[model samples]
Target: MTEVFFYHLQKQSLEAVLPGLLEKAIERGWRVVVEAGSRERLEALDAHLWTYREDSFLPHGTAGDAQAALQPILLTTAPDNPYGAAVRFLVDGAPFASAEGYERLVVIFDGNDRDALAAARDAWKRAKAAGHDSTYWQQSERGRWERKA
Candidate 1:
């Protein structure tokens, strides 16, 4: 069975680990969907990897066509694994809801950001209500990303 490990890491840790992770994923032929706040980080990984800015929206002038522009990128482009495998590395309280669409969701919380932690808790509630087996990890200033599980 294939397993997806969700890593909740700090920006610094992400920067250090991403290149190697991407390379390993490619080498293993594993599908990866990286959700992050920084466009630079995503672009740095590889041009072939699809990058999605969860907060980005189409221009107001194209409000009606916004869904058309965003939906394909958000939903269709990332291929699915029949073996139910995938990982999510969330940063700054992002990527915390309805993980049902994916096999597993790993939430990364920065210990320094109280506000982001609160937001992540709220999102955790929503995910639980939606029936996803989710978990969270805290990244310390010492650069360790620790999780309960």
Candidate 2:
């Protein structure tokens, strides 16, 4: 079964939390696909991932970029996996109907948005119904992710 993790973002924005997770995935030698909710959002994230920090780098690209398939981290709005990534991050309430052939799936949602929260809950229910191994993580007051029952 595919392992699924739901990250409820309350304190920090997705821009803050995503890089760290992507870095970890890279460290594990897992190619990644970050599925955004829209093209504009994907473009914003593509730019942000490149220049999120002055010192560090998280190499990524979109389908429009040349040699996109070779990117270690590919960002897209489509449901298709272009880079053959084993790990996928679903942001902005991007739809995920199945977890087939994925090693892991990460769903990040804004805790403040009612629609996003509803979407997250729906995703959780689908994951559970599909019998995927799922876990939930919520940020603490100190701004650290902690697993919740």
Candidate 3:
């Protein structure tokens, strides 16, 4: 069964925390796929991943890229995983039909957005009912991620 993780963003924006999570996934030798709700969001994330910090670089590409399979991280609006990534990240309330093939599924939503929070809760319920091992993580006051439930 796939392990599902729900990250509720409160103290920081997605831009502030996503890169670090991607870096950790890379450190674990896991290829990743980040899916956004729209093309604009996917493009924004693609650009952000490249210039998020001055000293670091995350090698990534979009589904339209020719060598997408070579990228450790691939960004897309659709659910296709061209890189055969072990981990899949759904951002901006993007919905994933199933967790099949991926070792882990991560859902990141803004806590400040009532709609996003409601969607996350629904996803959590669905994942639990499907027998997936799930966990909820929230950002603390100091901008640290803490497991909540």
Candidate 4:
């Protein structure tokens, strides 16, 4: 069964939080695919990942980039996993179908967005029904993630 993690964003924007998560994933030596809600979002994240910090870099590329397979992290708006990632991140309310091949699936949704929250709930139900191990995480007042469910 796939391990599914749901992150509810309330205090910070995805841009503020995603880089840290991606960095951790890279530290774990996990190939990753980050799926956004749109091409614009995907592209924006692609750029952010490059310049998020002055001293750090999260090596990644989009589907159109050359030698995409060599990238440690791949960004896309679709469900395609060209890099054969062990982890998939569904950001900005991106759709979730199945976690068939991935070792883990991370769903990051904006807590302020009713639609995103609803979608997360539905995804949770579906993942549970599919016998996946699921966890729900929410940001605390101190800006740390707390496992809520």
Model 3 residue runs over 4 Å out of place are none
Who wins the lDDT comparison?
4
Residue-wise C-alpha lDDT for candidate 3, range 80-118, written one tens digit per residue: 877689999999879857888889999999999999999
Supply the global lDDT for candidate 3: 0.91
TM-score of each: 0.49, 0.97, 0.97, 0.98
Q: Candidates' lDDT values, in order?
A: 0.45, 0.92, 0.91, 0.93
> Model 1 off-target regions past 4 Å?
1-12, 17-29, 38-41, 44-85, 92-97, 139-145
Model 1: lowest-lDDT 10 consecutive positions: 56-65
Q: In model 2, which runs have C-alpha deviations exceeding 4 angstroms?
A: none
Candidate with better lDDT, 1 vs 4:
4
lDDT of 2: 0.92
Clashes of each: 1, 0, 0, 0
TM-score of candidate 1 to 2 decimals: 0.49
Q: Which residue pairs in candidate 1 collide?
A: 8-108
Cα lDDT, model 3, residue 74: 91
Compose the digit string of candidate 4's lDDT tens values, residues 1-149.
89999999999999999999998899999999999999999989988999999998889989888877899999988898877899999999799899889999999999999999999999999999999999999999988999999
lDDT string for model 1 (3-61, tens) is 22445556454545554545554455444444554555334433333332344321111
